[model samples]
Target: MNKQKYWLPVLGIFVALIGCITINTPIKAADTIHENYVQKIKAKKELVMGTSPDFPPYEFVKNIHGKSTVVGLDVEVGQEIASDLGVKLVVERMDFDSLLVALETGKVDMVISGMNNTPQRAKSVSFSKNYYQSGQDLLIRQADIHRYHNYRSLSNRTIGAQTGSIQYSLVKQQAKKAKLKGMDKDNDLILALQTHKIDALAVDTATAKAFIQNTNGLIRIPSGFKTSSAGSAVAFPKGANSLVQVANQSITKIRKNDLINKVYLPKVSKYMTNHKSKKDRQKANSMWAYKDFFLAGIGYTLMISALSVCLGLLLGIFLSLMRLSKNSWAKKIAGAYIEFVRGTPLMVQLLFIYFGLGIVVNIPALLSGIIAVSLNSAAYVAEVIRSGINSINVGQKEAARSLGMSRQLTMRYVIFPQAIQNIWPALGNEFISLIKESSIVSVIGVKDLIYQSRLVQADTYRGVMPLVITMILYFIITFSLSRSMKYFERKMGHSND
Candidate 1:
């Protein structure tokens, strides 16, 4: 009958079904299934880069138009990589030693601070293709040039190198009988030589050259000393293969397009000239010129101290209550925690939080600082509160109970207020102490007052002025807090009268 027409309609339906199947299938199945690091970066529309911007030519901060900004070859390369990925670039400045930890904790998408691919670092993070090669150089005081002019001459001399850098390893292995001291930044190493803290510093030739050229009283030991070559590369979190591939492509493109030569070199030359010139030293050396940086540091230091102390107070109250609890287990647990925290130095706690617990917890530096400092402060505060509570006369509790107050009500209404009044001075001292202790968080790159002082010291290469300014700021803050606290104590005393 209509067999041909019926078959034709069925054939048309079959073709339509096949076309729909093809359309539904992803053209790149691997990309969708893997959803690798590069895709995640694109989805976020921002590539977070971690850097320690104290290395000149590779990365360093410059005050441009009255704003501190990081600029150098590495920064320019980071821009290119972000451009290639069609995403915005966000640079996070931290201590060089902390950069790897930051990357592993997912705090940053990439690291481009002139990092060299060392075997130890390679084990944790994958690196892109090498973008620049530099040789290790020894920097000594100009007067000591004849003293440490060669590797053999450097024997038994104290040597400095940037911590977690290829130069650090180079100093350890190559220099004979030299005491190896690891600094946290290129600026630190330079400043060490300037301050006579270390006899010499091992740094990349380019960086050493920049430092020697710009600063007075430093000399570069002539070449012919055998040292391993260092190649700078972009680092990605381990297993970030897609990101590594994209980064490599960008590095290759940058090289082929001569971006480093045309753009980066010219910028480097300009930066070197401006930064190295004798006239710029006055500005670099002056504390007044760096007022904004110090102020920002002061603000951060105050904020962190205030927040940490508040959190500590809350936790301390809970801990004090736990210590006073009828439950033996609660008291024991509280006692152990207090001993463990109070027995250890705040620096150890900070390092543990940033390097050890950070692996599992994954928090920002500011949050980590708050937690570590608060936790430490809580231990002391708990003891203070416990003592204050016990110091109250037993007759007071008896009086409250005689009035038919419940145990909870007696503690809350009568005991706590008196305890606080007695401990207010101690608590005020703690608050002031925390402000100074907050400086410890700088090792983790929290950018507080002390950290800012270090940054300024690094930039200016004059240690005294920056530290003097920081000291003055600290005194002002602590003195103000102290005076205010005394005023409060007087007011409370008046009220009692």
Candidate 2:
């Protein structure tokens, strides 16, 4: 046989064998049925609803059965929807802005936090049929009611709103001449109004009424601003038509049955008439009443900060070594990681980890917070370690090498000890900074100091006092840590002496 012909036949046979050999790897079924959000709710036996619970009568934390659980009209509405779907309801309390992200990332199936559908928000998520409609009102100090009673009078005055809220937009567009300050929580907005950081606040009529009823020295000027009527709806991820359909049906049923009037409005009225009396305000401001809430919050904040520092130190050491490596890939990878983490805002990272990464893997809020914070802290910590190592005289390393010490041993004993001593102050500062910044994790629903304080504010309907206490707690913590760092520095200096 000719050599070429024989080789061609043999090659064909090999190819045929390769085609015939089947690899029996199991690919998951498309499972479109299981993947539908409604189906997922059925399979999981619970519907996760996200809300910022600081808004009263819509969603807020209240002491329930001796435990702090989210409550209010929106929560009740969520319960109704869950019941209609024959699934349990779980409320995930987060910041107002985080609700949409949570829905987009599947952290929650729906956002029912009395959220208004605006053009900008509609681009990112779909809204259910309107469940309720609310008009905008200006909440001002009773003294300023005469001054800021009308839209024209709002000029140049600083007005407040919850960040990313419809009220914020109303203030910006309708009160365009006025300066608008957006805060993260209604409690904060109330505090700002009281502190005179803002002269007026644009809030929904119901919310404004609620605030005015409990809060002294504040009144809602009903005739001031004519903000276009806004409707509250449940938001779902884009393309979640099935979820949208069912949610809309529920909303229709709710409205058709007058549930909002019969159930929701009555609840609001109950709380509306339930404002704290003068005696209650005095008690609410008393430290003894809310000390436990603040203390628990401080404890969680400290734990998160401590763990984040330790994790950061360990990971930072590795990253520093990687960056210092002679290998090109290691240097590039470590450098890129450090820059990326340092470049992005920590809040964005926290959202990505808790909701975005959460799509692939389920992580507890506390663990997710620690991991996100540690990763962020690690980048700075690595830089600190690297700088400390570089500050050590090269001669010391060379002398250690000349004394027959291995590079690893010299780094372990002589270099690291000295670098730690040199960077002790910086490390302490990082820890202290983390203590303060840990409040950001509250957006992910971690009940840290700020979260606890917000809860106290809601419980008491007095924002300034709780915040003042929180500020003092933070000051005390940071001051004590600052002093400890100074002591450590002095001890290190004396030892060197």
Candidate 3:
């Protein structure tokens, strides 16, 4: 018997085993079932629907007499669907893109926002019957209103769209000649449109109509914006066959009976009338999309500030010592740390420390945020302190040394005190800024003052109220501290500005 022939059979067996293992390990994730989907909605008595509220006409929270109600078309339709199914409706409002993520993450049973049906989306989620049809329209400033002739007219022109939506994909593919800036959400692109950061924006016609209601100085260009069957539907992840069947039947029955049209659809169309009123439109514009989500934002901001300031001071002091150190290793290492923090993004550092580094160190979430903020802040503080130290002149240290004092004693006794005195005002301003920058922390899940405000927004859906409160809170916190420091820095002058 040949040994090679015997080895070939053995090699085939090994290959077969590896192939089996690869298939069994799961190349893709199975769609997540809605959390507690089968646990009986009748028993739970609450049916949760996911939506992005910022898209008006489909779904939005309007400040009606100073109260926020879920009253848009999608909201009405969701309520009707819940009623028909004999379950109470519960809406969990979130960012537009997060709605589908929530639905697939099993946080929501269904999503009925004005979601479009596409094969790509269908691969991830199942769609129910279409409720409404809309088309992509271009939003442009009054200055460029006549520039668009058709979607082709958009070719070679700069366009902006929300990052994740099918609109983004469409414009990217069809308008290859078009310069497109994809932003985080619809609101960002809308702001860019107003600011003229981008020449135009491609969005759904209904959304364009809604934007006209809220904004001035912009009109939709007529010719190139062709209508498409942008059908609105209820969607669940694929593999949710039972849920899909239930939803399609529910939507079909609701559409056929005119309940979807009569009750749900009208709730949004009326807002088109109010768009003409300057006072009402301004009030509407005042309502921010993130208003409901601003609860922890205040605390997060301040925390970032406090942590950054505090950490910056401590670490800055240590680095300053190294900057003055005689040892080459100490100076090089300190230089490296300072350069790293100063060169990179403070936001990325904040995230890395929170999500990545802290996992291994086991620090409390608050402390981790503080530490990251501090690390970044300290680099700047180090430079500030070094500048202050250098400003004191070498004469003071030489004078102290001539008085029979050591180098360490000269710095401690003669130089540092005066350096601090001169830099006090500059340091105070930096500390105040740290508090303002802390607002970024709310997204990282730290429940500070801003975080509390987000909760208020979530409940009230009143954007300005919580934001006003957060601003007032921060202003009070920072202003009081600065004023109190005047007694210490006796020569310090206050600036009204």
Model 3 scores a TM of 0.60
Model 3 spans with C-alpha error above 4 angstroms: 1-36, 40-45, 84-88, 106-109, 143-145, 222-230, 271-434, 441-497
Encode model 1's per-residue lDDT on 42-156: one tens digit a residue.
Answer: 9999999999988877887776665677788999999999999999999988889889877766678899987888777888788899998877677889898666666668777
Candidate 2 backbone collisions, by pair:
none
Clashing pairs in model 1, backbone N/Cα/C closer than 3 A: none
Q: Which stretches of candidate 2 lie over 4 Å from their true place?
A: 1-35, 223-230, 268-277, 359-363, 486-497
- lDDT per residue for candidate 2 within 119-158, as digits (tens), equals 7898778788889887777888988865776656878888
**TM, every model:** 0.87, 0.86, 0.60
CA deviation > 4 Å runs, candidate 1: 1-35, 223-230, 275-281, 351-362, 494-497
RMSD of each: 14.7, 9.8, 11.4
- Residue-pair clashes, model 2: 0
Best by TM-score: 1
Q: Rate the local accuracy (lDDT) of all candidates.
A: 0.81, 0.81, 0.67
Which candidate model has the greater TM-score, 2 or 3? Answer: 2
